[model samples]
Target: MKKLELTAQAEDLMKSHSLQGFPNEICGFFYGKTVEGVKHVTVIKPVVNAKEGDQRRRFAIDPLDYMKAEQFVIAEGLEFLGIYHTHPLHPAIPSEHDLKQALPSFSYIILSVQPEKVVDITSWTLNDDRAFEQEEIISNRNVNTSANKAS
Candidate 1:
């Protein structure tokens, strides 16, 4: 399976956001450009954030911000590479509900906050059967480095 390279800051942000979204799901996207030699897989996110949602954690992007994000990515030469979400009281694995809603081309990242003490994050690549195939995350903490560039 392919591995994902995430920045340490990105990982911590994801954990904190997941913990904060404690009873519901929290979602967002990743943005970055490809580092040479990484090819299509090199695209990564320097930043990640939670989208607005109700108390239940059901969220949809702010229409204006969504459009702006698309525009920003295009203008900045970044890719809308993956989608991330937190499972407040669940495991760091995709649920049946998640599989049903997942889009094939995008990577599905799940952050589980069941422990209440810390958040556990995992990535999955879905197949035709809607099963989540486990993947890896390589966390980068250095700035001004090409470690997690998106393609």
Candidate 2:
């Protein structure tokens, strides 16, 4: 099984973002690198949810935001691993709209937020058949610290 590794800080940031967004969905980009075949999230850049209305059930990343995030990733010397979004009151599963918008070779992290808390977090990737497959999440506080020390 492929693994998506996240530093404790990254997880905390996502949780905080989700909670802050509350009844509205929040979206962002995940910046990281793949080490030994494991995708390690080093940074998460939260962006405004550009969906015009009824944001409680959906979220969108503005094209300008996407471009800026890409540039930021390059400037920081990190890869644009994928996207992360909150599912206000929904489960941490991709929706039909997500399926249609997903791009191959990118990881998608979904967080289920209820009221003022995040209930779950899950990572996913599209397979050959264009179906979503869950990726294993490995949250470790030491991973990023050790990697930075090696640098």
Across residues 78-146, which tens digit of lDDT does each residue of candidate 1 receive? Answer: 776677777666677877767777777567777777747455788887777767887777766774323
TM-score, per-candidate, Cα-based = 0.72, 0.92
Residue ranges of candidate 2 with Cα displaced over 4 Å = 144-151
Residue pairs clashing, model 2 = none
lDDT assessment of candidate 1: 0.62
| Candidate 2 lDDT over residue span 1-151, tens digit each | 7899999988888898889889888888888899998998987788888899899988888898898878877897888899999888889999999999999989999999998789999999999999999999998888552122100
By lDDT, the best candidate is 2
Cα RMSDs of all predictions? 5.1, 4.4
Q: Which pairs of residues clash in candidate 1, taking residues 3 or more apart in a chain or in different chains?
A: 32-150, 33-150, 33-151, 34-150, 34-151, 43-150, 43-151, 44-150
Task: Give model 1's clash tally.
Answer: 8
lDDT per model, in order?
0.62, 0.86
**Candidate 1, residue 70: lDDT:** 80
